[model samples]
Target: MAFVHSYQDDDDAPAAAATSLRRMELLLDPSLPQHLAGLALSQRGVLTTGQLLAAGLNRTRIHDIGRRDGWRTPLQGTRMVAVQTGPDASQDLMRAWNQAAALVLPHAALGFDSAAVEWGLVGVPRCDGVTVIVPPGKELRARPGLRVLVRPLTTHDVVSPWGLRTTSMVRTLADLLPTLDRPSGLAVLDGALRRRVRRSDLATARERARGSNGWRQVDDLWELANPDAETPLESRVRSRMIDGHLAPNALQQRLRDSSGRVYARPDMTIDRHRRRRPERGPLYIEADGRGPHGSPGAAYRDRDKASDLLADGADIERFTWDDTFDPMRIPWRLRRAL
Candidate 1:
């Protein structure tokens, strides 16, 4: 399948090809190395075959160097190249791939999970392919590690932050939430809210998406989103609890002493009044993701906090990323605790 540039018809192909040839010829000047370096830097070490050609390298030379050197062609059936620089190269691979996609398809805007990444929104799950949305009636065939879709988009729905065209954060959430399951969807919403996305903007996006597919899911998840969720894992756990009919009475509830001095704040709290038995006191749940809770100092503090809460006649439960994989695990354990 051939990738067509925006606004180019069969009649324009010959002119476009000639223009490309002339551009390549001009790029083969003595300053080619500098041009190639700048291009690679701008793209985070990713280069296209056209770029290599412009730098005076033939396809055979490009392929040989790529195979011999540490350079990687991340996207198959495409001319995209990623130069593996260091240990963190894999971390930036997706970003570079997204940049390459934007470069190749200038009229397309990064959408869905890829757009969420560009917007720096948390809780976006890893997707295997890059997604871009073109104007309705545009035809871009899907390639390996790349997803192209045609969707209606207004000028206000797109942005070019850091020079990469991407769907606005609100539009991205509206387009993305419905495609995910409840736990994942709520996590993304919680993450967007945590990033200070206004609820009014989200409401507006939801209303605009009213008649679209997955609109109901988006509407329902919006109501459940909580800004108090500090992390994606916490949001997922809370969502699971809600699904199991054990939504917490309060989130990030402050624990204070008899003197009214705040001592600890748990990730979530369930009042005994909300449980079947009121004699057992409140339940505190801590969602311990690896980053914040894995350190030796953090471990000591957690133990101390647990001791204090236990002494204060409160039941406590701590969960990690693994515990959230099983949808029923948290609810069952909390049920037993209650």
Candidate 2:
């Protein structure tokens, strides 16, 4: 049998054949130099000028290939690949958008909320542009399709992994530790530890982070995000309480009343401080980072538990995110309360 042939041109009687060929090429090779893959494999099909250049295609060849109807550069000197798809499509566009920015900036890495999404800390809706963290002195000119963010980072803060410079796994989690609630922060810490970023690495990063304005919080997070933590929320709370000097008692210390009713153990407990005035008594401490007491139901349970402690002639003091930030104020507040 002989093959059938059809001919069509820009304005031919049946000009759709040319368009059909282009569509077939897209179907076969989604990795086209200037083609934006599609809604299905959004992250897998992005190509950049550098990628094309690596494949032996020069700018002139790239231009010639796109001489006719081709991909548009949404930003001047920046190309965008628009594949044929529904306007309303839910795409896993984060990785692709980030890849584009990485390709353009080459020096910046995704950080903060951007890296949190990559490292599984938070869920983000589909975004159009890339969020990048660049070295302090590097400035990228404004471009139409790209939203450039120049997050200043010292050399110690940059980590090169998988051939890309990103915030180190520990540093990425540390960056979000202060902003994230307890459970979320615990989740991020768990993820990082599971990926084999060690506590020692976190310790080192924290040590280096000193003198940096926001880094004390990072150190606090290190203690809070313990890899061996079975009860992460409680652990975080305990660490914060100890940092605030509110937990004079050892972590996981056991306790019992005069009647021998054992308290399994409080995260932290301080024996009552007997003041000259009967009103000043020893107090118990609880750490209230985001996770251990994050949910409304959990908060209710905690309130009930605190009420029980009060009934037992124990005053209870709790610490939170603010306490972690300014730890010195905690002891003062506790003294006044006593």
Candidate 3:
């Protein structure tokens, strides 16, 4: 309920509100601009100048509304109203942020990793800021905090998830495949498959990507993806092994002692058949080579398990995040252990 600052007074209120949705919502009258308010609800309570006109707010009245209501233009020609909320703003990804960006640009849709995040996809690369893909010929300008891409988007290639215009899940994955390494791409596929998206979901996407630049890589990931992967770490480990041409014998393979006593289920396993060199022997690998070992008790338990595995004559290799990123380390270590 605080008109923190006046928009007409030339204060920096607009810029401040642009980055904070809670503050922006506080300035809008939900009852007056019914359509704009409804649209803004999906756009982080932020509206564009064009949307204002669509809502029946004339140019003069729009200016009057801006001055009277403290509407700020964070980006040129964009308008926002601040609402009230706590000082603790989360840095975690917000769907409303992308909605606002898309709503600002005509025919703009969130694409690639942007769409993937909106669909709650897991195991892809960590992305920040916003990415907006506009249909070719749309008059949109690049803005800070937004990456604008122009492409020819087809009917099947686009979707509206989270009430925001974005590329379809299939198209989104295809868009992201080339940008990521094989392992990172598998993580995305594995995550999607875990959510029950099968190879069938990608049929149209595969057809569309025929002969495209990264089609081969995407195709490989589609076939190589295993829903058994429970985490991004696991997918990354599998990817490195594949890169080294060391396909696992089985994912999440169960381990047992001579008497069939199940010990631990490592993320991946190499059976006698999958072993490239018989001398290197059977292998079991854990994605978390480095233990979080939050407590001394936890550390002791892990050490105990390691001791047991050693006694069983199992060749185990542990890979950490650092090892996964280094092209030489994890693959080379895995090869040596195998």
The model with the greater TM-score, 2 or 3, is 3
Q: What is the C-alpha lDDT of each candidate?
A: 0.73, 0.52, 0.67
lDDT of 2 by residue, 1-338 (tens): 11111222232112012243211112223234333333213322245665556666689966765554364443344444434332212232444455456555677777665555455343122355655676557877656546555666877666544334567555665555655544445545644564466778767656655665555544455655544433444444544445555545445555666888864355555555433346644576666767667999988888777776777666777766556445466666666666
How many residue pairs of model 3 clash at the backbone?
Answer: 10
Evaluated against the true structure, the overall lDDT of model 3 is: 0.67
Q: Candidate 2: deviation at residue 192, Å?
A: 6.0
| Model 1 RMSD in angstroms | 9.9
Which pairs of residues clash in candidate 3, taking residues 3 or more apart in a chain or in different chains? Answer: 23-82, 23-83, 24-81, 24-82, 24-83, 25-82, 25-83, 26-82, 26-83, 27-82
Once fitted onto the true fold, the runs of candidate 3 whose alpha carbons sit more than 4 angstroms away are 1-91, 94-96, 256-261, 273-281, 289-298
Better of 1 and 2 by TM-score: 1
Candidate 3 on 97-130: residue-level lDDT in tens? 4656766564788887667766667666765557
Return whichever of 2 and 3 wins on lDDT.
Answer: 3
| Residue 220, model 2: Cα distance from true site in angstroms | 8.8
Please count the clashing residue pairs in each candidate, in the order shown.
Answer: 0, 5, 10
Better of 1 and 3 by TM-score: 1
What's the lDDT for residue 121 in model 2?
40
Residue 68 local lDDT, model 3: 85
Per-residue lDDT over 1-338 for candidate 1, one digit per residue giving the tens place of the 0 to 100 score: 11111221122121122122110111122333656654555565567777787778888877766665446555652344333344333434566678778777788999998887776566767877689999878878888788988999999999885677889877887788777777788888887787678899888767766777777755777878899998899998998898889999899988888899988999999997876667677899999988888899999999999988888778998888788789899999999888
For model 1, what is the error of residue 228's alpha carbon versus the real structure, in angstroms, after optimal superposition? 1.3
